[model samples]
Target: MHKVIIKYVLIGVLAATALTSPVRAEAVVPLTVQQFFEVCQPTRVTDFVDDNDYIQFGLCMGVIVGLSSLMDLNCQLDRNDTPNHLKADLSGGNTSLTAYRQTMWNYSNDNPSLRSFPVGMLAASLAEEWPCIEPL
Candidate 1:
């Protein structure tokens, strides 16, 4: 009975700490540009391609889209430059995630470079084509 009480107390403490942990809205490290490249190596990409690892590919795409959304929230994306169609699609439904994933894969494949990070590159491509007249 004592052990059971201690276990419940410990769980409650952990839950409280987790809930109260400081989570900044913006990260100190720029994930899209640097972390993406570090994590998504050419070899990994190749492995996914060769294996047709849809699961892994989907996970990576999800992360990229998430990062892109964060960038958008941080006023990094050019909303003004984004086409109405793209914006509409992105805001419309879950299908937009697929669209972004396709774009990321094609962009990453065509523009392979040591300096290029797939997520950052994709974000830049979108910005360049549909740059906001001013930062949001």
Candidate 2:
């Protein structure tokens, strides 16, 4: 049927466009600071945003919340040296998901040079805020 043929063609074009898009291509890996910031940070004022921004904001919150939840689960990277271990501490904090997203965005904005490294960027911001207690 012509309709079926058109549907397949449309799907193919969409797939090809996603594959060829630089942003989508790089998204296969963990989002780096630059990537995270670009996706998460709204370029326009809230009132001026188009419907597309809802998708962007939703995606941004999802990533931020996922990362925060991992931290809450006490994600740890232990180095041989006790003091070098990384962990999160969300005790007694009233911080919301939006706060976490903003904090991360700020960190990314402040450190453009570290944009390529996701974990490192996380370590510098989230981990540093509430690091693990070193054992004696």
| Candidate number achieving the greatest lDDT relative to the actual structure | 2
What stretches of model 1 exceed 4 Å from their correct place?
Answer: 2-58, 74-95, 114-119, 128-136
Model 1, TM vs. native: 0.39
CA RMSD per model (angstroms): 9.6, 5.6
lDDT of 2: 0.63
Mind giving the per-residue lDDT tens digits that candidate 1 earns over 39-72? 3433344455432344445446667577457544
In candidate 1, where is summed lDDT lowest over 10 consecutive residues? Answer: 22-31
As a whole number from 0 to 100, the lDDT of residue 112 in candidate 1 is 60
Candidate 2, 1-91: lDDT as tens digits: 9999999999999999877866544332236777786777634346534544555566666677677766655544434442332456554
What is the TM-score of each predicted model, taking all chains together? Answer: 0.39, 0.59
Residue 111, model 2: lDDT of: 84
Off by over 4 Å in 2: 1-30, 42-45, 75-85, 132-136
